[model samples]
Target: AVESEAEKRDRATREIGKRVMEGWRILDKKCDDCEVPMLTQGKDDDKGECVLCGKGQKKVLTEEERDRAVSEIGRRMLDGWKLEDEDCCEVCDLRMCSKGDKKECVACGPVLPPVNVNLELPPNFDFSDPKALEALLLQVQKKTSTANQVPPTPALSEQKEVDKVNISAPNTPNRYGSNSNNYPNTPSSMQMQYPNTPSAVPVTNEEMSMIGAEQKIREGWTMMSRAYCDCGGPMMRAPNSREAMCVNVHCVNSCY
Candidate 1:
């Protein structure tokens, strides 16, 4: 005999209840249909969900309502309902969980990586220097413009000339004392090779204020706000400070 839709739903509900019982907090609020109490999880108890019906509470859990809340997020995650986002589901206030793409209720399953990708800078990049910034941007533009354009086959003579320029350019010493030949052709690798390169200009008071900001950004500090710096680079809110500051190394007006 085949199972009916109601039976399938009842089975799914039972499975969810069993999972929730392992760690989730049981609430006093009963499901009108099932007559069973609801359950919840999350730091703020922001995820009140019906264990049998999988319906979520639309309103905030009251202080008395949530007095039964427990600290079982660790254990629940270990049971495989990982990557929770509170109140993400539109149909139910239940927490959404999964690894990627399918974000269903805790029992339904899905998750995604955090959306923000950190803005990476090349090693030893001097954002404050006009010349260095110009060079880097121009190199990036050149790479972009050529990436899609297919050139006609170069004649042997032309190819030799290109190779000669490429080879000789590496021997030229940059503002830093070291020859560029020590580095790879890519901007990131080139920067990596010049760890000891001294800044061409002296650091000003404005630039000094921006010092710890970049490290904070790299460490995943949330952006508070943004505006354009005088040099066209973005000035972002400094962590734990009211002022917005530029991340540019060459711009003297780094903060306002």
Candidate 2:
């Protein structure tokens, strides 16, 4: 097939870009707007350019631009940490500097801690879906309602009545007879006697936590049963958020 004018022009442009960036180092980073591969030049890789788009960076970025770039980089990184580029070493052109009175790059001086980024929703989050939005809102409302709720304490008379019932329940006569000793005073026996009534078992702190986690799992808020975190730990979905976190206490990123 004969090459169209537009195709020929695009091919020519790519060829020209290749020649122009022949000696430059190709970076793994891509242009945000063009989605084209970027290349860098100079002794410290300070200069950057897109092969196809001609978008180049020669001068230092402004404070706002630097901050925005750091956020963008953090979002792209799997480590979930943002970098400070305010005083990056000119020698390495990298932001591996210690955040002190005087920032120094580790490659040339000292190590710096990366700032942790906020937990973001999963990549598959869809804001346009009405059902998903409704579910999220409902979860938020449920949590709010639970937090604001205060259990009403029993009055002294009510407590006395409850105590009386508890003391008399065991002595109450049954078809088997009061002194028959046919049943023990165990929970099982009580359950047998009052089969239609619900048991009021006192839940421990640990058991309560487990029950809450199980409830979330039942509501399809967690994927722990089907999927594992990167650290080989069970993953639970964060409340009111699409983010999933490792449930293993020993895992370094468990809190995340």
Query: How accurate locally is residue 180 in candidate 2, as Cα lDDT from 0 to 100?
Result: 30
Worst 10 residues of 2 by lDDT: 159-168
- Please provide, for model 2 over 94-210, each residue's C-alpha lDDT reduced to its tens digit, 9 standing for 90 to 100: 454232343433233332232222222356745445575445445443443444344433322122222111111243323223433422422233211222222243222222222
Q: After superposition, how far is residue 157 of candidate 1 from its true place, in Å?
A: 73
lDDT of 1 by residue, 213-256 (tens): 33334334333333455554445564467776664433446431
lDDT of 2: 0.39
User: For each candidate, what TM-score against the reference?
Assistant: 0.21, 0.19
Residue 131 displacement (Å), model 1: 79
Candidate 1 RMSD to the correct structure: 27.5
Tell me the TM-score of model 1: 0.21
